[model samples]
Target: MIERFIELGQGYGDLYEMLEIMKTNQERIHNTFVFVSEKDGKKVASFAVAMKPVGDSKFMPIYICREGIPYNAEKTSQRYDLFKEGIEAANKILITLEVKHSSAYVETTLYYQYLIGLLRLYHYIPNLG
Candidate 1:
Protein backbone atom coordinates (compact mmCIF):
# COMPACT_ATOMS: atom_id res chain seq x y z
CA MET A 1 0.00 0.00 0.00
CA ILE A 2 1.07 3.56 -0.56
CA GLU A 3 1.03 4.93 2.98
CA ARG A 4 1.21 8.70 3.00
CA PHE A 5 0.76 11.65 5.32
CA ILE A 6 -1.91 14.12 4.22
CA GLU A 7 -0.92 17.49 5.62
CA LEU A 8 -3.90 19.31 7.11
CA GLY A 9 -2.11 22.55 8.04
CA GLN A 10 -1.33 24.13 11.45
CA GLY A 11 -3.93 26.31 13.11
CA TYR A 12 -7.06 26.13 15.23
CA GLY A 13 -9.12 25.85 12.08
CA ASP A 14 -6.96 23.02 10.86
CA LEU A 15 -7.26 21.31 14.21
CA TYR A 16 -11.03 21.50 14.03
CA GLU A 17 -10.92 19.86 10.67
CA MET A 18 -8.83 17.00 12.04
CA LEU A 19 -11.32 16.47 14.82
CA GLU A 20 -14.12 16.33 12.32
CA ILE A 21 -12.22 13.80 10.26
CA MET A 22 -11.86 11.60 13.31
CA LYS A 23 -15.50 11.85 14.24
CA THR A 24 -16.74 11.28 10.74
CA ASN A 25 -14.51 8.31 10.09
CA GLN A 26 -14.60 6.68 13.48
CA GLU A 27 -14.80 3.20 12.06
CA ARG A 28 -11.85 3.67 9.78
CA ILE A 29 -9.58 4.93 12.51
CA HIS A 30 -6.75 2.46 12.84
CA ASN A 31 -4.89 4.52 15.40
CA THR A 32 -4.44 8.04 16.63
CA PHE A 33 -1.24 9.67 17.85
CA VAL A 34 0.05 12.86 19.37
CA PHE A 35 3.64 13.54 18.44
CA VAL A 36 5.35 15.91 20.86
CA SER A 37 8.58 17.68 20.15
CA GLU A 38 10.53 20.78 21.03
CA LYS A 39 10.88 23.54 18.51
CA ASP A 40 13.10 26.51 19.37
CA GLY A 41 13.04 25.23 22.99
CA LYS A 42 9.26 25.32 23.27
CA LYS A 43 7.17 22.17 23.35
CA VAL A 44 4.77 21.61 20.44
CA ALA A 45 2.52 18.83 19.22
CA SER A 46 1.28 17.25 16.01
CA PHE A 47 -1.94 15.27 15.90
CA ALA A 48 -2.28 12.42 13.45
CA VAL A 49 -4.72 9.62 12.62
CA ALA A 50 -4.24 6.58 10.45
CA MET A 51 -7.29 5.45 8.56
CA LYS A 52 -7.61 1.90 7.38
CA PRO A 53 -7.09 1.69 3.65
CA VAL A 54 -10.34 1.93 1.72
CA GLY A 55 -11.70 -1.40 0.56
CA ASP A 56 -9.04 -3.32 -1.35
CA SER A 57 -7.25 -0.14 -2.30
CA LYS A 58 -3.61 0.84 -2.67
CA PHE A 59 -3.66 4.04 -0.64
CA MET A 60 -3.48 4.35 3.13
CA PRO A 61 -3.85 7.87 4.42
CA ILE A 62 -2.38 9.13 7.66
CA TYR A 63 -3.73 12.61 8.23
CA ILE A 64 -1.70 15.06 10.30
CA CYS A 65 -1.92 18.59 11.61
CA ARG A 66 1.79 19.15 11.94
CA GLU A 67 3.36 20.91 14.93
CA GLY A 68 0.52 23.33 15.47
CA ILE A 69 -0.38 23.12 19.12
CA PRO A 70 1.49 24.08 22.27
CA TYR A 71 2.31 21.18 24.61
CA ASN A 72 2.47 21.36 28.40
CA ALA A 73 1.69 18.81 31.05
CA GLU A 74 0.80 21.54 33.54
CA LYS A 75 -1.92 22.92 31.28
CA THR A 76 -3.85 22.18 28.12
CA SER A 77 -5.37 24.21 25.33
CA GLN A 78 -9.09 24.14 24.60
CA ARG A 79 -8.26 22.78 21.19
CA TYR A 80 -6.34 19.84 22.64
CA ASP A 81 -9.07 19.26 25.17
CA LEU A 82 -11.64 19.02 22.42
CA PHE A 83 -9.53 16.46 20.62
CA LYS A 84 -9.00 14.43 23.78
CA GLU A 85 -12.67 14.36 24.61
CA GLY A 86 -13.62 13.20 21.15
CA ILE A 87 -10.95 10.50 21.27
CA GLU A 88 -12.29 9.23 24.58
CA ALA A 89 -15.84 9.12 23.31
CA ALA A 90 -14.68 7.07 20.37
CA ASN A 91 -13.12 4.45 22.64
CA LYS A 92 -9.68 4.58 21.03
CA ILE A 93 -6.44 4.78 22.91
CA LEU A 94 -4.31 7.73 21.89
CA ILE A 95 -0.61 7.18 21.43
CA THR A 96 1.68 10.01 22.35
CA LEU A 97 5.33 9.92 21.31
CA GLU A 98 8.24 12.24 21.86
CA VAL A 99 9.98 12.84 18.57
CA LYS A 100 12.65 15.03 16.99
CA HIS A 101 11.43 18.29 15.59
CA SER A 102 10.76 18.34 11.88
CA SER A 103 13.05 21.32 11.53
CA ALA A 104 15.92 19.03 12.50
CA TYR A 105 15.70 17.47 9.03
CA VAL A 106 16.93 19.19 5.90
CA GLU A 107 13.39 19.05 4.46
CA THR A 108 9.93 18.38 5.74
CA THR A 109 9.67 15.41 3.42
CA LEU A 110 12.61 13.77 5.11
CA TYR A 111 11.07 14.30 8.51
CA TYR A 112 7.87 12.50 7.50
CA GLN A 113 9.88 9.68 6.00
CA TYR A 114 11.63 9.21 9.31
CA LEU A 115 8.30 9.04 11.09
CA ILE A 116 6.98 6.50 8.62
CA GLY A 117 10.00 4.35 9.37
CA LEU A 118 9.24 4.46 13.06
CA LEU A 119 5.57 3.60 12.55
CA ARG A 120 6.42 0.58 10.46
CA LEU A 121 9.07 -0.57 12.89
CA TYR A 122 6.52 -0.64 15.68
CA HIS A 123 3.90 -2.38 13.47
CA TYR A 124 1.34 0.37 13.92
CA ILE A 125 0.72 -0.17 10.24
CA PRO A 126 1.68 -2.98 7.93
CA ASN A 127 4.80 -3.05 5.74
CA LEU A 128 4.67 -1.31 2.38
CA GLY A 129 2.41 -2.88 -0.16
Candidate 2:
Protein backbone atom coordinates (compact mmCIF):
# COMPACT_ATOMS: atom_id res chain seq x y z
CA MET A 1 0.00 0.00 0.00
CA ILE A 2 1.18 3.51 -0.79
CA GLU A 3 0.28 5.73 2.13
CA ARG A 4 1.18 9.38 1.64
CA PHE A 5 0.73 12.72 3.34
CA ILE A 6 -0.86 15.29 1.05
CA GLU A 7 -0.08 18.64 2.61
CA LEU A 8 -2.79 21.27 2.19
CA GLY A 9 -0.80 24.30 3.31
CA GLN A 10 -0.44 25.43 6.93
CA GLY A 11 -3.34 25.45 9.43
CA TYR A 12 -4.92 28.74 8.51
CA GLY A 13 -7.92 29.15 6.21
CA ASP A 14 -6.87 25.86 4.66
CA LEU A 15 -8.07 24.13 7.84
CA TYR A 16 -11.66 24.62 6.76
CA GLU A 17 -10.97 22.79 3.49
CA MET A 18 -9.49 19.88 5.40
CA LEU A 19 -12.61 19.65 7.58
CA GLU A 20 -14.82 19.82 4.53
CA ILE A 21 -12.96 16.91 2.94
CA MET A 22 -13.59 14.82 6.04
CA LYS A 23 -17.25 15.79 6.22
CA THR A 24 -17.83 14.95 2.60
CA ASN A 25 -15.95 11.66 2.69
CA GLN A 26 -16.96 10.34 6.07
CA GLU A 27 -17.30 6.80 4.77
CA ARG A 28 -13.70 6.62 3.60
CA ILE A 29 -12.40 8.26 6.75
CA HIS A 30 -10.05 5.92 8.63
CA ASN A 31 -8.68 8.19 11.35
CA THR A 32 -8.24 11.81 12.38
CA PHE A 33 -4.91 13.01 13.74
CA VAL A 34 -3.48 16.05 15.47
CA PHE A 35 0.31 16.03 15.34
CA VAL A 36 1.87 18.32 17.94
CA SER A 37 5.40 19.56 17.77
CA GLU A 38 7.66 22.25 19.18
CA LYS A 39 9.09 24.72 16.68
CA ASP A 40 11.26 27.65 17.70
CA GLY A 41 10.25 27.02 21.34
CA LYS A 42 6.57 27.29 20.48
CA LYS A 43 4.15 24.38 20.47
CA VAL A 44 2.22 23.93 17.24
CA ALA A 45 -0.04 21.33 15.66
CA SER A 46 -0.83 19.74 12.32
CA PHE A 47 -4.33 18.44 11.67
CA ALA A 48 -4.77 15.46 9.37
CA VAL A 49 -7.54 13.25 8.01
CA ALA A 50 -6.53 9.74 7.03
CA MET A 51 -8.60 8.07 4.39
CA LYS A 52 -8.78 4.38 3.61
CA PRO A 53 -7.17 3.01 0.47
CA VAL A 54 -9.49 3.21 -2.50
CA GLY A 55 -10.11 0.31 -4.94
CA ASP A 56 -7.16 -1.63 -6.34
CA SER A 57 -4.86 1.36 -6.50
CA LYS A 58 -4.03 1.04 -2.82
CA PHE A 59 -3.33 4.76 -2.59
CA MET A 60 -4.18 5.97 0.86
CA PRO A 61 -4.02 9.74 1.11
CA ILE A 62 -3.60 11.44 4.46
CA TYR A 63 -4.72 15.04 4.05
CA ILE A 64 -2.96 17.46 6.35
CA CYS A 65 -2.53 21.08 7.32
CA ARG A 66 1.07 21.16 8.49
CA GLU A 67 2.28 22.76 11.74
CA GLY A 68 0.93 26.27 12.07
CA ILE A 69 -1.51 26.52 14.99
CA PRO A 70 -0.39 27.14 18.56
CA TYR A 71 -1.38 24.23 20.83
CA ASN A 72 -0.92 23.67 24.54
CA ALA A 73 -2.78 22.56 27.66
CA GLU A 74 -2.99 26.09 29.04
CA LYS A 75 -4.76 27.53 26.01
CA THR A 76 -5.84 26.77 22.42
CA SER A 77 -6.06 28.78 19.26
CA GLN A 78 -9.39 29.42 17.55
CA ARG A 79 -8.17 27.38 14.58
CA TYR A 80 -7.46 24.43 16.83
CA ASP A 81 -10.86 24.83 18.48
CA LEU A 82 -12.56 24.68 15.08
CA PHE A 83 -10.69 21.49 14.26
CA LYS A 84 -11.67 19.96 17.62
CA GLU A 85 -15.30 20.92 17.12
CA GLY A 86 -15.31 19.36 13.67
CA ILE A 87 -13.91 16.10 15.00
CA GLU A 88 -16.54 15.99 17.75
CA ALA A 89 -19.32 16.83 15.31
CA ALA A 90 -18.14 13.95 13.12
CA ASN A 91 -18.19 11.59 16.11
CA LYS A 92 -14.50 10.86 15.74
CA ILE A 93 -11.93 10.92 18.50
CA LEU A 94 -8.77 12.91 17.84
CA ILE A 95 -5.48 11.02 18.01
CA THR A 96 -2.84 13.38 19.31
CA LEU A 97 0.91 12.76 19.08
CA GLU A 98 3.95 14.80 19.94
CA VAL A 99 6.53 14.66 17.15
CA LYS A 100 9.68 16.32 15.88
CA HIS A 101 9.27 19.32 13.64
CA SER A 102 9.45 18.67 9.89
CA SER A 103 12.37 21.03 9.67
CA ALA A 104 14.43 18.39 11.44
CA TYR A 105 14.61 16.52 8.16
CA VAL A 106 16.46 17.69 5.07
CA GLU A 107 13.44 17.15 2.86
CA THR A 108 9.69 17.29 3.43
CA THR A 109 9.39 13.83 1.90
CA LEU A 110 11.66 12.42 4.59
CA TYR A 111 9.53 14.02 7.25
CA TYR A 112 6.41 12.40 5.83
CA GLN A 113 8.13 9.02 5.67
CA TYR A 114 8.95 9.32 9.36
CA LEU A 115 5.32 10.09 10.15
CA ILE A 116 4.09 7.13 8.07
CA GLY A 117 6.40 4.80 9.95
CA LEU A 118 5.17 6.10 13.29
CA LEU A 119 1.56 5.68 12.23
CA ARG A 120 2.20 2.12 11.08
CA LEU A 121 3.94 1.22 14.33
CA TYR A 122 0.93 2.46 16.28
CA HIS A 123 -1.42 0.59 13.92
CA TYR A 124 -3.06 3.87 12.95
CA ILE A 125 -2.40 2.72 9.40
CA PRO A 126 -1.57 -0.65 7.82
CA ASN A 127 1.95 -1.93 7.33
CA LEU A 128 3.57 -2.69 4.01
CA GLY A 129 2.20 -5.69 2.15
Candidate 3:
Protein backbone atom coordinates (compact mmCIF):
# COMPACT_ATOMS: atom_id res chain seq x y z
CA MET A 1 0.00 0.00 0.00
CA ILE A 2 1.20 3.49 -0.81
CA GLU A 3 0.16 5.89 1.91
CA ARG A 4 1.22 9.47 1.32
CA PHE A 5 0.81 12.90 2.83
CA ILE A 6 -0.71 15.56 0.59
CA GLU A 7 0.26 18.92 2.05
CA LEU A 8 -2.43 21.55 1.59
CA GLY A 9 -0.36 24.48 2.87
CA GLN A 10 -0.13 25.82 6.40
CA GLY A 11 -3.24 26.07 8.53
CA TYR A 12 -4.72 29.40 7.57
CA GLY A 13 -7.43 29.93 5.00
CA ASP A 14 -6.43 26.51 3.71
CA LEU A 15 -7.87 25.01 6.88
CA TYR A 16 -11.42 25.55 5.65
CA GLU A 17 -10.61 23.49 2.59
CA MET A 18 -9.52 20.64 4.82
CA LEU A 19 -12.83 20.74 6.67
CA GLU A 20 -14.72 20.70 3.41
CA ILE A 21 -12.77 17.66 2.25
CA MET A 22 -13.95 15.79 5.33
CA LYS A 23 -17.55 16.85 4.96
CA THR A 24 -17.71 16.09 1.27
CA ASN A 25 -15.96 12.74 1.44
CA GLN A 26 -17.54 11.52 4.63
CA GLU A 27 -17.91 8.03 3.26
CA ARG A 28 -14.22 7.70 2.39
CA ILE A 29 -13.12 9.47 5.55
CA HIS A 30 -11.02 7.19 7.71
CA ASN A 31 -9.87 9.56 10.43
CA THR A 32 -9.33 13.19 11.32
CA PHE A 33 -6.09 14.14 13.03
CA VAL A 34 -4.40 17.09 14.67
CA PHE A 35 -0.62 16.94 14.70
CA VAL A 36 0.95 19.32 17.16
CA SER A 37 4.58 20.26 17.11
CA GLU A 38 7.02 23.01 17.98
CA LYS A 39 8.99 24.68 15.26
CA ASP A 40 11.83 26.92 16.31
CA GLY A 41 10.26 27.19 19.75
CA LYS A 42 6.92 28.24 18.26
CA LYS A 43 3.97 25.99 19.01
CA VAL A 44 2.03 25.00 15.93
CA ALA A 45 -0.45 22.41 14.69
CA SER A 46 -1.18 20.55 11.46
CA PHE A 47 -4.67 19.45 10.56
CA ALA A 48 -4.99 16.14 8.77
CA VAL A 49 -7.69 14.09 7.11
CA ALA A 50 -7.02 10.43 6.37
CA MET A 51 -9.11 8.80 3.72
CA LYS A 52 -9.70 5.17 2.89
CA PRO A 53 -7.60 3.59 0.19
CA VAL A 54 -8.91 3.66 -3.31
CA GLY A 55 -10.49 0.49 -4.70
CA ASP A 56 -7.75 -1.98 -5.65
CA SER A 57 -5.29 0.92 -5.74
CA LYS A 58 -3.86 0.47 -2.27
CA PHE A 59 -3.21 4.18 -2.15
CA MET A 60 -4.33 6.09 0.90
CA PRO A 61 -4.13 9.86 0.86
CA ILE A 62 -3.60 11.72 4.12
CA TYR A 63 -4.30 15.38 3.54
CA ILE A 64 -2.66 17.92 5.81
CA CYS A 65 -2.18 21.57 6.46
CA ARG A 66 1.32 21.50 7.82
CA GLU A 67 2.37 23.22 11.02
CA GLY A 68 1.25 26.86 11.02
CA ILE A 69 -1.39 27.58 13.62
CA PRO A 70 -0.32 28.71 17.03
CA TYR A 71 -1.05 26.15 19.72
CA ASN A 72 -2.50 27.42 22.94
CA ALA A 73 -4.62 25.55 25.43
CA GLU A 74 -5.90 28.81 26.84
CA LYS A 75 -7.21 30.14 23.58
CA THR A 76 -9.56 28.56 21.07
CA SER A 77 -8.86 28.97 17.38
CA GLN A 78 -11.63 29.13 14.86
CA ARG A 79 -9.71 26.90 12.47
CA TYR A 80 -9.22 24.24 15.07
CA ASP A 81 -12.73 24.64 16.35
CA LEU A 82 -14.19 24.17 12.91
CA PHE A 83 -12.20 20.98 12.49
CA LYS A 84 -13.30 19.67 15.87
CA GLU A 85 -16.94 20.43 15.16
CA GLY A 86 -16.73 18.83 11.74
CA ILE A 87 -15.28 15.65 13.16
CA GLU A 88 -17.90 15.45 15.88
CA ALA A 89 -20.68 16.13 13.44
CA ALA A 90 -19.31 13.32 11.32
CA ASN A 91 -19.40 11.04 14.37
CA LYS A 92 -15.62 10.88 14.52
CA ILE A 93 -12.98 11.81 17.02
CA LEU A 94 -9.84 13.60 15.99
CA ILE A 95 -6.69 11.65 16.72
CA THR A 96 -3.98 13.88 18.10
CA LEU A 97 -0.24 13.34 18.40
CA GLU A 98 2.71 15.43 19.46
CA VAL A 99 5.46 15.06 16.90
CA LYS A 100 8.82 16.46 15.94
CA HIS A 101 8.75 19.38 13.55
CA SER A 102 9.20 18.57 9.91
CA SER A 103 12.06 21.04 9.72
CA ALA A 104 14.04 18.68 11.91
CA TYR A 105 14.58 16.44 8.94
CA VAL A 106 16.81 17.24 5.99
CA GLU A 107 14.01 16.60 3.54
CA THR A 108 10.26 16.78 3.87
CA THR A 109 9.96 13.29 2.50
CA LEU A 110 12.11 11.99 5.30
CA TYR A 111 9.95 13.76 7.80
CA TYR A 112 6.85 12.15 6.37
CA GLN A 113 8.51 8.75 6.37
CA TYR A 114 9.31 9.20 10.02
CA LEU A 115 5.70 10.09 10.71
CA ILE A 116 4.55 7.07 8.73
CA GLY A 117 6.68 4.86 10.92
CA LEU A 118 5.25 6.44 14.02
CA LEU A 119 1.73 5.96 12.75
CA ARG A 120 2.33 2.30 12.04
CA LEU A 121 3.96 1.80 15.42
CA TYR A 122 0.92 3.31 17.08
CA HIS A 123 -1.37 1.37 14.71
CA TYR A 124 -2.81 4.61 13.46
CA ILE A 125 -2.37 3.22 9.97
CA PRO A 126 -1.97 -0.30 8.72
CA ASN A 127 1.51 -1.67 8.24
CA LEU A 128 2.97 -1.23 4.78
CA GLY A 129 2.47 -4.26 2.54
Candidate 4:
Protein backbone atom coordinates (compact mmCIF):
# COMPACT_ATOMS: atom_id res chain seq x y z
CA MET A 1 0.00 0.00 0.00
CA ILE A 2 1.17 3.52 -0.77
CA GLU A 3 0.33 6.33 1.60
CA ARG A 4 1.04 9.98 0.89
CA PHE A 5 0.48 13.35 2.40
CA ILE A 6 -1.48 15.69 0.15
CA GLU A 7 -0.82 19.19 1.42
CA LEU A 8 -3.60 21.67 0.75
CA GLY A 9 -1.81 24.67 2.28
CA GLN A 10 -1.17 26.21 5.66
CA GLY A 11 -4.07 26.25 8.15
CA TYR A 12 -5.64 29.40 6.86
CA GLY A 13 -8.44 29.54 4.33
CA ASP A 14 -7.33 26.14 3.13
CA LEU A 15 -8.42 24.56 6.43
CA TYR A 16 -12.06 24.76 5.36
CA GLU A 17 -11.31 22.80 2.23
CA MET A 18 -9.57 20.09 4.26
CA LEU A 19 -12.59 19.76 6.54
CA GLU A 20 -14.90 19.52 3.54
CA ILE A 21 -12.81 16.74 2.07
CA MET A 22 -13.09 14.75 5.31
CA LYS A 23 -16.84 15.31 5.50
CA THR A 24 -17.33 14.32 1.87
CA ASN A 25 -15.20 11.22 2.24
CA GLN A 26 -16.45 10.31 5.70
CA GLU A 27 -16.89 6.64 4.83
CA ARG A 28 -13.35 6.41 3.46
CA ILE A 29 -11.92 8.28 6.43
CA HIS A 30 -9.51 6.11 8.37
CA ASN A 31 -8.16 8.56 10.95
CA THR A 32 -7.81 12.21 11.79
CA PHE A 33 -4.47 13.51 13.08
CA VAL A 34 -3.02 16.65 14.59
CA PHE A 35 0.76 16.97 14.58
CA VAL A 36 2.00 19.53 17.09
CA SER A 37 5.50 20.91 17.09
CA GLU A 38 7.57 23.79 18.34
CA LYS A 39 8.94 26.04 15.61
CA ASP A 40 10.87 29.19 16.41
CA GLY A 41 9.78 28.72 20.01
CA LYS A 42 6.09 28.90 19.12
CA LYS A 43 3.71 26.00 19.41
CA VAL A 44 2.02 25.07 16.11
CA ALA A 45 0.06 22.18 14.69
CA SER A 46 -0.79 20.46 11.42
CA PHE A 47 -4.19 18.91 10.87
CA ALA A 48 -4.63 15.90 8.62
CA VAL A 49 -7.27 13.39 7.63
CA ALA A 50 -6.18 9.98 6.40
CA MET A 51 -8.38 8.19 3.90
CA LYS A 52 -8.49 4.46 3.26
CA PRO A 53 -6.76 3.12 0.18
CA VAL A 54 -8.81 3.31 -2.98
CA GLY A 55 -9.95 0.07 -4.52
CA ASP A 56 -7.17 -1.60 -6.54
CA SER A 57 -5.19 1.62 -6.62
CA LYS A 58 -3.93 1.25 -3.05
CA PHE A 59 -3.47 5.00 -2.78
CA MET A 60 -4.21 6.30 0.68
CA PRO A 61 -4.30 10.08 0.63
CA ILE A 62 -3.64 11.91 3.87
CA TYR A 63 -4.85 15.46 3.48
CA ILE A 64 -3.01 17.99 5.62
CA CYS A 65 -2.91 21.61 6.64
CA ARG A 66 0.74 21.99 7.53
CA GLU A 67 1.83 23.70 10.76
CA GLY A 68 0.18 27.09 10.57
CA ILE A 69 -1.92 27.45 13.67
CA PRO A 70 -0.56 28.93 16.85
CA TYR A 71 -0.98 26.36 19.65
CA ASN A 72 -1.89 27.29 23.18
CA ALA A 73 -3.24 25.26 26.07
CA GLU A 74 -5.04 28.21 27.62
CA LYS A 75 -6.91 29.06 24.43
CA THR A 76 -7.05 27.58 20.94
CA SER A 77 -6.96 29.53 17.73
CA GLN A 78 -10.05 29.86 15.57
CA ARG A 79 -8.57 27.58 12.94
CA TYR A 80 -7.83 24.83 15.44
CA ASP A 81 -11.23 25.20 17.02
CA LEU A 82 -12.82 24.90 13.61
CA PHE A 83 -10.89 21.72 12.97
CA LYS A 84 -12.03 20.19 16.27
CA GLU A 85 -15.61 21.15 15.50
CA GLY A 86 -15.43 19.54 12.09
CA ILE A 87 -14.11 16.29 13.52
CA GLU A 88 -16.87 16.22 16.11
CA ALA A 89 -19.45 16.98 13.48
CA ALA A 90 -18.14 14.17 11.33
CA ASN A 91 -18.20 11.78 14.29
CA LYS A 92 -14.47 11.21 14.15
CA ILE A 93 -11.92 11.22 16.96
CA LEU A 94 -8.98 13.61 16.81
CA ILE A 95 -5.58 12.15 17.53
CA THR A 96 -2.86 14.61 18.45
CA LEU A 97 0.85 13.75 18.36
CA GLU A 98 3.81 15.89 19.25
CA VAL A 99 6.51 15.58 16.62
CA LYS A 100 9.65 17.16 15.25
CA HIS A 101 9.12 20.39 13.39
CA SER A 102 9.26 20.39 9.62
CA SER A 103 12.21 22.74 9.69
CA ALA A 104 14.27 19.98 11.26
CA TYR A 105 14.29 18.19 7.94
CA VAL A 106 16.18 19.50 4.92
CA GLU A 107 13.24 18.79 2.60
CA THR A 108 9.49 18.81 3.06
CA THR A 109 9.31 15.33 1.55
CA LEU A 110 11.60 14.05 4.27
CA TYR A 111 9.36 15.53 6.92
CA TYR A 112 6.37 13.74 5.44
CA GLN A 113 8.26 10.47 5.30
CA TYR A 114 9.09 10.79 8.97
CA LEU A 115 5.44 11.40 9.78
CA ILE A 116 4.37 8.38 7.70
CA GLY A 117 6.80 6.18 9.57
CA LEU A 118 5.54 7.43 12.92
CA LEU A 119 1.95 6.79 11.86
CA ARG A 120 2.78 3.29 10.79
CA LEU A 121 4.57 2.57 14.05
CA TYR A 122 1.52 3.67 15.96
CA HIS A 123 -0.74 1.58 13.69
CA TYR A 124 -2.54 4.72 12.70
CA ILE A 125 -1.65 3.86 9.10
CA PRO A 126 -0.59 0.62 7.47
CA ASN A 127 3.00 -0.44 7.06
CA LEU A 128 4.89 -0.55 3.77
CA GLY A 129 3.82 -3.24 1.34
TM-score to true structure, per model: 0.94, 0.94, 0.93, 0.95
Clashing pairs in 4: none
Candidate with best lDDT: 4
Query: What lDDT does model 2 reach?
Result: 0.89
Tell me the lDDT of model 2 at 27: 80
lDDT per model, in order?
0.88, 0.89, 0.85, 0.91
TM-score for candidate 3 = 0.93
* Steric clash pairs (candidate 3): none
Task: Summarize candidate 4's per-residue lDDT along 24-63 as a digit string, tens digits.
Answer: 8788889999999998889998999999977888899999
Residue by residue across 91-125, what tens digits does model 3's lDDT show?
88889899999989999999999888888899888
Looking at candidate 1, the ten consecutive residues that score lowest on lDDT are 77-86
Top TM-score model: 4
TM-score of 4: 0.95
Tens-digit lDDT string for candidate 1 (94-116): 88889999999999889999988
Better model by TM-score, 1 or 3? 1
Model 1 scores a TM of 0.94
